[model samples]
Target: MVAVDDMNRRILNLLKADGKLTYREIAAKLRRSPSTVRDRIRRMEDYNVILGYAAIVDREITGMKADAIVLADVEDGVSVRDLRKLNGVDGVAEVSAVSGDRRVIIRLRAHDSETLDTIISNKLIPAGLKDVEVRIIMEEIMRFPGTS
Candidate 1:
């Protein structure tokens, strides 16, 4: 395993903030040589520490005006593999299993409230999610890195 020392951690933090930064830019910020930064990044990539990169788009511009968090209980006999299948559903951004009264949580996005309702009713419910509770996201105060 590659040691994620202080330098590597700093490099990761810089990349997390802006994945488009070049090795030279990162090197300048961390006061390290570009070759050193490049080598560290390459090592991390080889070990799968850096899974991939993606564009963070504006939801409004993409016509995804509505966003909601759906918390529900998985019906008896539903397999973990089946739960993972929810990720394939349109507008289902995230699907997670947590320990709570409601074990399954899903992040959904759609064009409007009606469309969001349709996804829950037609898609999620039919797939075996029950006792569903949806909380619509009013505004995004902050977003984590690497998520659109």
Candidate 2:
């Protein structure tokens, strides 16, 4: 495990809230110098404690009006690539082979519910996915660290 010190944790927390915060701003909040903040962040990156950064956009504004988490009991013969390449799949945010009744879980985005339905019916069903459970995402409460 990466041994993150208290100061580094504070830096991470600040960055989690707002990745755009400059090193100077983070230093001011943490009562540290910009050089110190920069060095620590660089060190964290080197240690793989910090992976990368991204921007969080409003899906609706980006023409994605619907999001769903789909859990499927995929048979052993099913191809993940086929599942991933489905039409109208705006984004496959996550796909996991998990230990449960459901073998795969996928996070997807679409322009609307009708499109989502079409994708599920035409693509997912035909791809050999069964016992599918889809949950619509209404709100995002929190995001990953160092992301908007």
Where does candidate 2 stray beyond 4 Å?
77-89, 118-129, 138-148
For model 1, residues 33-97, the per-residue Cα lDDT tens digits are 99999999999999988888878889999999999999998788985458776767889988888
lDDT of 2 by residue, 1-148 (tens): 5569899999999988788899999999999999999999999999899898768787778898788888998757876555655544445566666778987787777888898888778777677789999999899787665543
For each candidate, what is the lDDT?
Answer: 0.90, 0.81
Cα error, candidate 2, residue 134 (Å): 1.8
Worst 10-residue lDDT window for candidate 2 reads: 81-90
- What would you estimate as the lDDT of candidate 2? 0.81
